[model samples]
Target: MNYPFCIRCGWVLALTFASCYPGLAQTPTPARDTSFTVYSALAKARKTDPSITLARPAVPTIIRSRMNVPYCTASGRALQLDVFYPKARRQGGYPAVLLIHGGGWRSGDRSQHVPMAQQLAARGFVAVTAEYRLSTEAPYPAAVQDLKAAVRWMRANARTYRINPKQIATWGFSAGGQLAALVGTTNEETRFDSLACNIGYSSQVQAIVDVDGILAFIHPESGEGDDRKSTSAATYWFGSPKTERPDLWRQASALTYVGPHTPPTLFLNSSVDRMHAGRDDMMRQLSQFNIYHEVHTFPDAPHPFPLFNPWFSPTLDYTVAFLNKVFSRK
Candidate 1:
């Protein structure tokens, strides 16, 4: 089938599904280099909506700058990942954190998550910020596949990057948070089994840091949410609406996959976001699974607040501490 084209950028996006597992020669295609610059995009997004603001770190980076690297291939398309690691501390391999960006599975870029990635890296972890296939080009699990491939790629190249292959964590904001939760909750016996290049390493994350990400597609309310927008996210990430694609929706839901072995998780949100129901539902599920999790509900923080404003720093501090605690253990 012919690939689709982006309306704004006129970028041709191929949607073919060939195995992107390691060892296969990557099918090459035109590189998508038009990703939004994180700083520029934030400034523009804030201009349209003053509620959004970029939060800067109080101190300078103790780590090296970003490393732009391609982590996956799909339909001849190359998806890139950016790595932020410590240049000063190189004696030992660091615990790793993969930062996924949120764009409703449609927009946003790796740069948007660079600050958080750098923050983690500066805190003694190898930070990997990745790009995935967007909904505008390919729908459903393509983005998930991109994330899976990134995990595989990181494991494959661990030594060179000074990373501990097993000490990996996935953290995301919004849609990316959902993806991180998906990685945290899923087991090797599920669909992800086929994608694992070798059983020696696992993609199960040590912890999941979710920032206002959706947990379940089974919206308890009827006609309450902006169906037009919500369904767009569901359809773009699950290939169909929750009603029509119950099975796939169930499979895709991170909440549904939580079990006794689920990695510990942290959720940050505010009362303003409509994800309260989903978040509550996820908490209940996690409780049932006996999973360890903590939720920080900012009084009036908006969605994507951490990346947008200074008020979100406390949450980032919590994230660094959470990483330190989780990685410090066996």
Candidate 2:
């Protein structure tokens, strides 16, 4: 029997790097001869572990294309965010998670992240997916502003969502990882704080999960080779090529933001991805600050293997454990 759950209400929310529509649960279509199948990972996992139960409760109510009130972007773009929560599980306030999707900040969808959000929700955390402005529509700080606004909106609506507000965490992939790191590091400054400050929301994240993201000017050999096609994501995010935008790149880099006050973080990288640079540098920074973090690297996997490879179930398993550990800290 499926247990019904409640839809959160009364909170004003924004989409930093999410969609304007309600979240949708999608099953991968069977297209023959494709390089990959959405079900391939799940199927492979179950084959190895027959005890796995793949069923998930239907999202009680998935919201879509809803505008974040008091839009935070300078373009006045009607930003949007999607929420997924269990209907039957409301005991006071719950832990909330924000997910940012990767597409070089040029192409990607909030729905692509719905499964991850659902996994968090099933494990008893409120999960949200966001959409941000792309380079085609706006450049650099535009997307950053949207991301900060989304965090602000969550804090603003904490009461309505039944979230603790203080327990919120963030996760992102690739370009989204950079934005997540930016949000994690830049809390007091309001580069996008046009919204009212009286509400008392800060863009700081309590913990962050960075997947296959760059952490320093130094790369892990893969991301350092070609200038044009290889490092395109970094080039676009920093608004200039790595050489021309050295200072700007460092400023946006998470490695530059470490401090005693920085939030705990978990990092994932693959040996094959060109963007895997700076994992060691990031570890050093974390050690210097004495900050808390966990690192996982897939030696033979391709870039983004964590998102696509089911062989490394440890990625999500460790992530859930880490979230519990950090969020429960009082």
Task: Pick the TM-score winner.
Answer: 1
TM-score on alpha carbons, each prediction: 0.80, 0.73
Q: Per-residue error at 64 for model 2, in Å?
A: 13
- Across residues 9-71, which tens digit of lDDT does each residue of candidate 1 receive? 112222222222121112434444333445654666576567766776653447775466766
Instruction: Report residue 187 deviation for candidate 1 (angstroms).
Output: 3.0
Tens digit of per-residue lDDT, candidate 2, span 115-231: 677766666777778888754445466677777778877788776666767888888877677677777876655655554432477776798888776666444443521353333
- Give the lDDT of residue 181 in candidate 2: 73
Error of 1 at 296 (Å): 0.5
State the weakest 10-residue window (summed lDDT) of model 2: 1-10
